[model samples]
Target: MNAPPAGLEIRPLTIPRTIDDPDAADFIAMTHVRNLVYAETSGHDDGRMAPAELLPNYAPDPAEIRYSWLVLLDGEPVGRVGVDVPQEAGSRVVFWLVELRRSVWGRGVGTAAYALVESTARAHGRTVLQTWAEHPPSPGDRLEPPTGFGSIPLDHIARFLQHRGHQLEQVERISALDLRDGLPRVRELCARATEAAVGYRAVQWRLPTPPEFVDGYAWMKSRMNTDAPAAGLEFDEEVWDAARVARADAKIVDAGRTALVTAAQHTETGELVAFNELVINNDLTEATSQYDTLVLSSHRGHKLGMLVKCVGLLAWLDIAPESPRVLTYNAEENRPMLDINEAIGFEPIGYEGAWKKVLSDPTTAGADTADSSDSSGS
Candidate 1:
């Protein structure tokens, strides 16, 4: 095995209750690095979030076990590691990431950090490890997954993953819509979708979900794991109830972020068959993020997906008037959703690869680590 860099130390991260807490110093530094890494890789600051706006996501939760570490070189923070294990019964899936600054590339920092991620998953009996990374356009060889809908440059990040036994299972398109261009096309699409969705109507609300819609919303959230196109990646079928829904809402609100949920309800049965989410940071001038958008399998063919997305974007304009743009992601194979996005003026901004590795033996994790001078940004 290759030796890790000298003076490199991986220490557990402490999530403070608030930004004002005395123990928040490390958290704040980590948040800054996180934002910097994202901006450096994506060429935009849309993913930036204040420490107060990011702490709630790292808070303790019952449905999943999360482990994080700060990678320090000579006692100075340089990178971060994360591993997430779902609480679902018989779940063997573990999601992880090892993000470092470009300046730290070729020093074996990422490889060393990845060792920790692998060990954590092994300890938790998770054999299926998965991760996603943004690969900005680069001129070089390209790699395509089995789905054949998108490709990513076989650059530093790809080589690192390939050397460590990970396979590229899928590619996702990162898309954005300029709110400055106005929502005329979106409005037109919404009208057509509304006419096509004969028996469904759009219902909208802000985060502490209304009492009447809580159960339906929870049901759709659970379906997100099963209904989405995951290619070869594995996702636990999440269990969501009113309590879980409340916890999720609290996380967003506590982070000083606002979430708007737009769902399509069946008129006769009063079931929320489809839904979309739009979230904005405390500063509305920044870009808005389009979160989960899903329509139940049984409710397909009614144009509900387009209905919810168009309705959500239109409503979001009024909610975040100053927000510059809206960002979103979709599996390349999800053409129906992509069609809607394209029709409404959302263009492809970037692409990301979804990678997976199945450990044949827990004890042998990262034993064949590959030597690469590449940085994996968050």
Candidate 2:
């Protein structure tokens, strides 16, 4: 897992067709490159992964069209790219991830890799190709003292993506909350939210959403697509139902992760109005992710978002007390959620740019005009 040696020739690397069947050596090399590139880009240590951890995520989801490649130089992996194409009807969206070793950055490797990803996605009848990029905020932006939100330096990836015509869609602030700092503020917020939500009660569950609440939960989840500020990115409202929710829950469980969800219920109507989720993988001692936190448009003013989030955090702490921090990303423009996050002691660590590019229009063959936009923290 040491760094690949220098003085290698630059060329397009052929992707292994059956990476899921990788030999022990190939698996080790791929994981090494993935972690190395991730660390270099984010300035953080990539958590150590056991063999089981790698095996579980090795195969692509059967329900979606997926493509991936390891960028190799002189027979050594130096980067990687992956594309995820969902199977929903009338949906032409494609999600992508591209990472390269710091040594090969600014050398046209990433640009070339993206060109391949773009063409492949277009060939697959995908209209929208999107990925997130980590970059520094503008100089004019202020960096809050406790957290370094706007202080990171701009890197080559941002410029490379721009050169390839990908527009910066949305700027997302990456924030972290240290659970060890105590949840006094969070508890206070929960109290205020509960008081404000006069006729609402909070509910908590671990994965496999209760059947009775499935319909209400689906309704709230669908609203997240439409109600959240998306800046200018073009994304269709995702269709959600009990089946999809169950499938998602199953996937999380299959990946050795536990989902702790807390929801707000209308005391009078017995309907769920808001919910938040936190995911903790098998490695409970590391970090947990704050997944979705949505408050329905009809139920926004009562601080339900804050309440569900607080409830979820407390629930997570009880279940996984070994966790040190919880991380979440919010669109810089999402002031309401950002305010709630800040009030709960979450501090910004960095920013992410949601970049999108429209490939050839599915309806128009050979159409070369590509549209680009950025929005939301995804």
Candidate 3:
């Protein structure tokens, strides 16, 4: 830790955090500050992702590797920021986590943490120093455009990103289909899609996704970058392998969340061409359906995307009838999938534009499996 230029000094935080340290006071106090500042400044509660009490092991054990430090100004713990470089992130770059404290909000505390975050990532032999901030969308890329979302509109940490030069990339819409309506017609459309692909066909496979197929599924996910737009994302495709695949499976098993999927696979080669995964929230708050649609250059003609979804919908309905709705996000430009979702009755719940900022400098940008694993949380 270098002495932060003159009036400010930044160094590693020495707050003890462990799952067993139930009396984690600094951890708890910091959570309140973070959540308050986050919600007040950003408009949504940030603490919902992980409670302050969870400072120790926000994630499960095997994946249980986390190192963070608190920032202080002249001795008062102003804010805290840390790095979470997962050894692996479901085939993605083990992520980089950077969080800040409130009182230190405008004091160059963030700039200081920014410096520390990069140093930390480099120390771990990681090349990327990624962090997510709610800045406005960048100038180009029709897929993404400016939407008035600053870190927290009324307030704005995201402004820091734009000022810094991060660019906006992908925006996700939360959509839902009232499954209470039954899917006789949706299934029929799926069956029709299956029938239409003469040489190509839709194959429905269930979990116990076969040890051999895990890598394939991870591969399919990594392809989100293909047509899927993201900001500052440098996709590393090699991260997904058999061992990592099994670790993912083991994580799910250990967490006890059931995986139900219906994906479109190549009939001749059995290569997984397109897919969707559905999760049943054990807490029963609501079931989640994550659908990622893809097509190989050779397999582009068939309605495999739609077919897989309909089949997956039926499967989810059958398995988790207790589910109230099915939800997903589609870029507004993606009319084709939108057409299918509409045909099956999924409608927009809310819209949010994904924003990125390179600032003058760029920071590319969670945890846990205690039962619930929302993408934002990790």
> What lDDT would each prediction earn against the true structure?
0.90, 0.70, 0.54
Candidate maximizing lDDT: 1
The parts of candidate 1 lying over 4 Å away from their true place are 374-377
Residues 251-347 of candidate 2: C-alpha lDDT, one tens digit per residue: 5776677788899999999989898989877788878889888988888799888889988887777888888889898888788999999999999
Expressed as tens digits, the lDDT of each residue in 1-378 for candidate 1 is 346889998889888888999999888988888888888889999999999999999878899999988888888788788899989999999989888888787788888888888899889888999999999889989999998879999998998888889999999999999999679988899999999999999999999899999999999999998999999999998999999999999999988898999999999999999999999999989999999999999999999989999999888888899999999999999999998899989999999999999999876655756886544644
* Model 2 stretches astray by more than 4 angstroms: 1-29, 46-51, 54-63, 136-154, 360-378
Backbone collisions counted per model: 0, 6, 23
In TM-score terms, which candidate is top?
1
Return the clash pairs for model 2, or none.
168-374, 169-373, 169-374, 169-375, 170-374, 170-375
Model 3 clash count equals 23
- In order of appearance, the predictions have TM-scores of 0.98, 0.82, 0.64
Descending-TM-score candidate ranking: 1, 2, 3
lDDT of 1: 0.90
lDDT per residue (tens digit) for residues 1-378 in model 3:
222334554454444455237555556555554565445433433223234233423433444255666555675555566666655454323344344544444545566556565555555556543454432223432333443222222123434443434344444455688777787889789778889766665555555568657866878766666655454455443355666556655544434455666667776787887777765434434546565566554566688777778888887776777667776767655667777888888876544434332222223331111111101111
